[model samples]
Target chain A: MSASATPVALGAARPGLFGFTRAQAVGFLLMLAAIVVLPHVLYPIFLMRILTAALFACAFNLMIGYVGLLSFGHAAFYGMGAYVCAWTLKFWHLDAAAAILLGGLTGGLLGLALGYLAIRRSGIYFAMITLALAQMVYFFCLEAPFTGGEDGIQQVPRGTAFGIFPLHQDMAMYWLVAGIFIAGFLLIHRVIHSPFGQVLKAIRENEPRATSLGYRTMHYKLIAFVISTFLSGIAGATTSVVFGIATLDGVTSARSGDVVLTTLVGGLGTVFGPVVGAIVTTSMENYLAQFGSWVTVTQGAVFVVCVLAFRRGIVGEIAAKLRLSL
Target chain B: MSEILLETHGLTKEFNGFTAVDNVDLQVRAGTIHALIGPNGAGKTTCFNMLTKFLPPTRGRIHFKGRDITGIAPADVARLGLVRSFQISAVFPRLTALENVRLALQRARGNSFDFWRSETALRRYDNRAHQLLFDVGLTGLADTAAGLLAYGQKRALEIATTLALDPEMMLLDEPTAGMTHADVDRIVELIRSIRTGRTILMVEHNLSVVEGLCDTITVLTRGRVLAEGDYATVSRNPEVIAAYLGSDAPELAHA
Candidate 1:
């Protein structure tokens, strides 16, 4: 095979406005421009909601796409981070950045512990183990008092950054959310291109061969899991601050499934696929809210279609046609 | 005489009540091709597995380079400069041929986790991998994905990967089991070239290939060593003739 036939590095020469690949960078810049400009023309609250979901979807993709590990219980970490941040901000009166960091740490710890066990198996078993463990966390959240159970922790303080800069408005929160999303995206990109990422791909391709080649495959899997969950936690913390709520909905299996659906729709192992998938799916959920059960039916149908006919996903399909690795 | 590189004492394998390999003592000298030929159900592959540390012997001691490594992990065994190629090709299908050799070199050099440097920049590894590919006559297909390579090419690549480890000894189980005549001839030639530097212990079924490539041959039947010596002596032995060729044997009549 020719060297060109192999998948190349992401955003090699043409880094967009936000350090994304040319296409993503261009699309993201346009989206950012729209976020800044269109909010005046459209509703700021609606856009913020979409942007938050997009960030969460991108974080989820860090695991599924780059690492090739399907996490069904990502919502457990996401919801846990959200709850930890919300509770800390509301009861302990912590700053927003600190709360988000605390949320990320919590998610990382959970990932470290759960990933150790889940990575013992591969393929479908790995997915099931993660889902089952996440369910345990979900049950704990439902019963835990700090989480406020069905009521959720409400009126979380969207405290200032470092006690100086106030993020009291939607515009300010949008910038923060966008910045966090971009950072997470860049980190994921760095990891996928790094030598560490190459080993993960090697493991994904053939675990036995990787092991025989002297790799501690389980260690790599755990690290990837932790990184993925930690990013997912950042999204959760941001969501809590933006909406001033933390609930069991974030930790539910359905919520986890939603992230998978988004990643799959965007692209299974593609970098920008999850972001695009998140944006499109969140918008569909928002507009189809009035359609009741049909919204779920429609989402399920999209997932089925993506899996059966478009396994490469929207971003993957585009990349294949254009002969790019984006 | 060459130095002994691999030695086993009381090497035995038991699967439940049945003993697959029973008290087989073996010593492979350096820089010679040692062929272990056996009929079906003979414990040749099991013995290979034991030597490579893939399967722990039920009762035995294996010493490689004067170090006891009876129950070490397979990776550890490979790291110790004793590598084994599988009966079936086990190359990474997704990786290109160069990448596969590069991975082996990385492991052999204990650099499996060197994440910061680009693989392309590792000139030493890249050059050695390229050289090994050339040595195996796979220089033309360096960029081919191992999975896409032809059967003969895959086998050649497997040998190249094994060589990338820079092993002192090689344990190859059925290297030419499924190859065509041309492929088999190519493998025999490759084995011949490789035996100049490292001790090679191979399990082969084809008598002609065994006679052509092996300096010493150990004939096995029903989990026991039936005959041992050079091909000329073992081929003429009555026990080997009875066990391997059976009663209707044209070669035995000539002998």
Candidate 2:
């Protein structure tokens, strides 16, 4: 094969440990440093908001970016995680870690069932199936007696961390939220670089070919979906703990759209794009909250700009221009 | 050799009210190169698809390696050692050439679900992937993405990736379709090199390629077999000539 035969960047992958390109390693360190200092420089709750949303977007990206799936109902997992965590923490009185784990497990189970059905279809139909299933989940939450309907599960207790550290303090809760976000972020990286991730990419790029090559493409897709949903659940559960509420907004379509915006704003397939996108989007929402309905218009404007000026999204454009993979 | 590697009986496919493939019986022997040739709309592709389990035959029984595999998924067919290539050169476009081959190798190893292990664990197949690439003249393009490769290189990469599976029987669906003569010759040689120990069932158009590479030929017309023999015998068959090559008899004869 000739050098000219290969396309640049996306296709011209250089060898790395666990799939980290040189730019990815550098980007990871920068993100680490920023997170360590972020709480001190910014409002802790607001920063936590960004962290939670960031993790959600990153998990969404694993399905969107690596697996070439566009899930319109990801908020289903996120919201479900939040409700499960809140219920477990408040009623069952489980430790924080156990609650989060249980929340993830709940999301995974939901994913397994939904993914089985969704993986039966592809393209727009697949997206619709997920969205419909998520809407059904939303209605379930509404009618369920435990969710408290309109009021939601308010004042969700942060409870004890390993029965020692108190999470009642907002500052104390921030660390756990940040830690979960960071761990999820790194885990996504590990996954995208794994053999399973490779298969996901193969299925994403060309499904029929992957199948002809002896791959159980549907099974691989279901597993990827479950993993993505599990992580999204963890992010949602963490956010519910920090914010002390599990409401309809958690599973709403609008929330689902927000993660899509954040992922797109950062860069769909770029490694660090979703985190950066989350920060940018969260900051923009906070800055524009007083503007009321104008916030949606402003978001529309951003989407317009992103599509027209930067089809690859911010991080994607940067990675393409720099000949790097972040 | 008398051993049958793949045999399909009463294979039929109907699209709504139109019959695409009529009841057809096809047999492929082990360690031989077999070709399915016919005119357009003769259901050659539909037959190949049914044989490879990409399409369910309206009525058929397909046996591979002496096991009834009718209605099996393509993945299962592949596991049974009968892998089919697409009409177009199918590959994971965004992945590097090496990654494309490595995926096939990993799939063959029954470890595609190992999500926790780093891809470095796949490095064990790197040497073999490189060798396969080298075999198809794509060694230097290993790191290049499959989509970015030139058209001819893409076909070569596809073959290299398919070879990574170490299949007992291979299916080539128009392996050289839309290729320059130079590229076509390269594939013909590549196919020949891999045919020594394994069985091959191919659907091909270019008569010269089918003539040069295939050990036996099955000619189809109107979704049914018209002639079955060596290339020379099939080419001379009055029915094969009238139904398919009559208009291009001189051209085919020259080929």
Candidate 3:
């Protein structure tokens, strides 16, 4: 094996942190600084919203951007996580960390079940199956007694961290949310640059070829699906905890659409695109709340502009122009 | 002359009542280049698909290394040290040449499920991958994306990735289908150099490549084996000449 004595040194240099390029490392540092400083400049709650949205978009990007599996019913995991987290905090009296972990587990379990069915088919059919299954989850949430129907699980206590640190303070909750977002973001980066991620990219590039090379493409796709949904669940649970409510809005198809929009606007495949996209889109919605329906009109206009003018989204276009993976 | 490494019995495929490959049996001895040469519509690819388990046979059984493999998955078939290359060069186009070979080399690290570990863990494969590329004369193009390479170079990269598997047997489908003469000769030499200690099953339209590189040739016509022999014996068969060579039989005999 490999008996030839050629000394080709193309891959001699190791990548920067977590396989990130130097530019990407710098970008990551800048993002960290922003996360740290932005809470003081902007309202902490608004910043938290952006953070949760960014986390959710990043999770969703794992499917569409990397694995090429566009999950149209991601709201199932997110909304289910929210409902479960709210229930645990309100009824079980679990701390914030425990509740969120339970919520994330709920998402993962739901993903395992639904992803099993959805991944049986591919392309639009896969998207449709996830949508249908998620719709079922939405209906279950709507009809379930614990979800409180239209009222949802309201006034979910923010509770304490590890039974010690209280999360009632906006700054405390912001820190927790920010920490989750950063962890989720770094975890995703690690996954994307890992050996498993290389196989996933190969499958995305040419699945049949990957299969011929002895990779179980379905298994890889399924695992990626579960990871994506698990993270989406975390984001949703955190949102419910922050807002003190778990409502039907969290499970609506519109939530799924919002995530897809954010990922698209930020960049489809780039590592940091979803975070940038979440910041832009979530900020727009928060600031334009006074403008009512015009917010959607503005969003639609921006989406159109992005699609036509820069198909790569904001980060994608930047990465393409600069020849650096952001 | 040696033990049969791959053997098929009554393998058939039917698509909507149209039989693509009829009941055809084939065998390849271990460590020899076997060629499946046929006319344009002779079911060579369909038969190759069945052997690779890419398509489930309508009725058949395939034995690889004396184990039944007809009912297994394509990836499972590959994992058993029986790999196949596509007629069209099937490199992961976006990946660089080194990355393409590194992909096949990664199975050495057990399974491809280490998503939590950084890709730097895969750097161990770089040297071996580079060697495989060099084996196929792609040393200078290791950094180039597979998509950006010239056609011959892309085909060579495919071979490099295939070699990274170190398969016991390889199924090459039309390894020199569309090529300049120089490229074809280069591929022939590449195949010749890599043939030691491995069995190769190939589908070819280029009879001269078969004559030069293949130890045994199986000629197919109308989804059935028409002749099986070494270069001179099969080339002289009147039926093979009439069906596959037609009026060009004399020129083929000379070749």
lDDT of 3: 0.89
State the lDDT of candidate 2 residue by residue for A63-152, as single tens digits: 888787889999999999999999989889899988988888888889999889998887789889989999999999999998889899
lDDT of 1 by residue, A3-62 (tens): 213344322233334335576566656656766686777667676666667667777776
Q: Model 2, A137: alpha-carbon shift in Å?
A: 0.4
Task: Provide the overall lDDT of each model, using Cα atoms, as 2-decimal numbers.
Answer: 0.79, 0.86, 0.89
| lDDT for each residue of candidate 2 in B24-66, tens digit (9 for 90 to 100) | 8988898999999988888999999888788888997989988
lDDT of 1 by residue, B44-123 (tens): 99988888877889998999999999867776777787788888787777677887787777766754554444433334
lDDT of model 3 at position A12: 30
lDDT of 2 at B11: 87
Best by DockQ: 2
Lowest lDDT sum, 10 consecutive residues, model 2 chain A, at: A1-10
Candidate 2 residues lying further than 4 Å off, grouped into runs, are A1-8, B245-247
lDDT of 3 by residue, A279-307 (tens): 99998999899999999999999899988
For every model in order, the TM-score on chain A comes to 0.90, 0.95, 0.95
**Better structure of 2 and 3 per lDDT:** 3
Clashes of each: 0, 0, 0
